[model samples]
Target: MHCSVVADFFSILKKKKKNVFFCYAVLPQNIGTLHGLFLFFISLFPFTLILTTDNNYLFTKKKAKKFSFLVVWVQFFLARKKISNSTESIMDNAPAPSVYIKTSPRDSEVEKAQNINSATPFVTLPSLPVPISRGQCVVYDQEVLICGGLYTRDCYSYHVLEKKYKKICSYPKDVKLRGHSVVKRVNSNTNDTMLLSFGGYKNEKKHTLTMKYVSVWNGEKQTSNCNQWLPLMDKNEDKPIIIGGDEDDYDGMRSVIGGSNNHLLFITYRPKNIDVFNLDTFQYVNRGILPSDNWIYFHGFVSKTKSELTSTSTEANEKKSEMILFQRKTGLAIEYDEDSKSFDFRKLSVFDDMAPLSEYAHVCINDTILFFGGHGGPKLGVSKAIHKYSLKENTWVKFEHNLSTPLSDCVSVLSEDNTYVHILGGFNDHRDEMTIHVKTKATDWMDEKEKEKMQIYNREKELEKEKNRKKLQASHFFCCCLFFYLCCL
Candidate 1:
């Protein structure tokens, strides 16, 4: 009966006998181990296989039980080998590093000059808190303050020199203010670093009434104790001539205008007027009847110029540049000259080509204004183009490259090194998520065509992996067979 069983196993092996040697190595000797001498030798076979290199004993009847044990051991070896090879192949096909923007020095000569001019190695500041979205940030001496922002109610203050957020007393919880203008009071006899906060939404429902309050923050304390919110006019009037003081609070705060000295300026969108306040006395000076444009959002920046104008009277007054107003809807600038303490109101020539995507895209970097990333108009689909407003030339220059992704509500700031624009917290197209982007050089200002190419390259690599998958499977199978043979000894 034992001999008959051996014959049946040999028939099964023959039917699958591509590797006859490997099949034979698993077979027992053609005799029963129940015989006393064979049983003794069968118990010793595993030990002999462990110590000896001879292959002749493998075919003996006494080695049958040992051979069967060896075959079970070789199966585990083959399975382990198959797993290792497959794991190795998978690791080799992993994805590349994700680098959407890479910035290096633009000019070799300029880099050399910077190296010579370097007084100390610069330490970068930590990223801004609240991740600014469509707000205004201003720096004066050592303190950088952001005021009147969207999405966030609390203001942020950073000490640029020390790289720390100043611990200041908090304001009243009920006072929800934003979308306002801030101006640094440089010429005040007592306080050189006071910011005048004007305009922005005040309450729950979006109201058309202009907000009449002005807030002052001392740069040294960064404290609300030193900060005070004062109303420009009486708050109880039915048609209160304020930016965010209407029946309900919305439509954002008034746009701020900084003067040559201690006086501050502001304008309303609904009632359409301008108002001024003296920083020293907190006096209200109303300037009546602004331009008829209703859908305008304006901002002001101080520009001082001392020049000799040769007039008929042969008398020269040092003419400081106008506190410029940027009209959001029109993309036009209205200049308020200091000579008359009134707006010169010149129409900035807007070419049909110069319409910015929206007011949200406009940002001020140092002396220049940058505009980009707009929703699609009738003709232009969601523009990724960048436009620069040169304060010196009073002209716009279009940068070559657009953003890597189409995003709005991004926070863009010039680094303390003054070498890079760090843009943070915007949408990421590749991941279909919101991601941070730090724009370090001129190349980053460009369009998205380059980033799209790298994305396409990664997809092709995945395709190549699928094409070679069959070859990988065959390689793993051979490795399993070889491992099984090694274990059989």
Candidate 2:
């Protein structure tokens, strides 16, 4: 908060130097006014610091209550107003036709153009549904299947297009999970290409061993069914995390003959207790563990543009698709050595220019592993700038975007084309509560390219809107003049 305040002060001072100097006129009689303003701002600083800083105020229930109330009041007065203003201050529509597609550089030509872009989005949520789960959600086939999570009890699934979300019917009345894996099957021969949900909290009890279940939806019958809960092949031991689960269709006849969709890789927290489970064969093979905690936050996503384009609808045109696993907890990278037999797990690096990525948020698109806002340093809430790690270049590319406010716990999801990453819901330090934050502009490399086009288009639309206003005024004036002339005649 201090850093943000200082940065803002510098920016304002730079832009309005005269005004800043004028403030210096807080001399003599105006000294009282300056002092009062300074005192007011000092008082406005959040009270949370008082708890951590002042030992005298620590460990008192009565004082804590008072401090909590003070913090809430400050957020209600200052932060809420700022957030509310942001929604109305920005233009939420696509750039006007004149701005993006202009006839000439002339102001008149730009101004005369009409805006053809729609303000309404192609998709809109009726209401932000009561989010049931958090960490690593999966959108399989069509429905978004969110498993056991950091928050909430029963797991739930929501249809992306239908806007309908209900508790997972197959999910027992009371079951909770943490560190689970959810994968979607794509075999065309079988009728039940179900959503494979594995691991995490099976019930209120926090069990180290991971569990597995599959949910199947019948389009014809319009009824959903879930397979019986299947425990891992090796369940006696603790910390059995089912990290990666995907059909190995690459090795030609090897995958087809093996029928290996449930090729599960299980990991224990210890240094060397990794095991592989081939559900089709009902066999468990011992594989050495990874040196680092890579598989803990690893996410396996099948890319569609490389050699193995299996599940995606546009596979034919897309040419290739490789299963991508992202290891966020370790760093801005993915390690495959312990899991995959072929490649030795190397730190999958990205563009160096886009340095210091957020360790928390990352997503896979084709050959790119995109990361967004996270606490950069050891400090609990000190998040760095946004970044994208391209698998193609094996390097990082810095993104040009600044959040309205600092936040954490936000989630990102890619649309079908993987063009726009829709960031949603997070906790802000200012508000100190969970709030929804969406990307208003591009956070990718092409932001500068889009910015130029948007500027020109906007100027044209403004001019066109102005012309319409003038025409209406002229028509009104002529009508009044003719009426007065006829009256005189």
TM-scores of the models, in the order given: 0.46, 0.45
Q: Which stretches of candidate 1 lie over 4 Å from their true place?
A: 1-127, 159-171, 200-257, 268-273, 284-294, 298-321, 325-333, 337-342, 351-353, 361-368, 372-384, 391-394, 407-489
lDDT scores in order: 0.41, 0.37
Candidate 1 lDDT over residue span 344-417, tens digit each:
45455432445544433454543456665544344554455667665545676776656655655444555433
Off by over 4 Å in 2: 1-127, 131-133, 156-167, 201-275, 291-343, 350-359, 377-384, 402-407, 416-420, 424-427, 430-489
lDDT, candidate 2, 1-489, per-residue tens: 000011123434566632221111101111133333542443443222222111122224444445554563353234334433443222443321211112334445323322212231112233334443234355553445544444543444555434456555334434344444444444433334444444433222322122222433433233322433333343445324343333211110000011133344333322223344454344555444444453333222333232223334452323211333333433322222223332234445434432222324455554455565554334445353566655545555665554545555455565432334445444454434342424322224333543453344444444554455445434544553453334335
Say what the RMSD of model 1 is: 28.6
| Best-fitting candidate, scored by lDDT | 1
What would the TM-score be for candidate 1 when compared with the true structure? Answer: 0.46
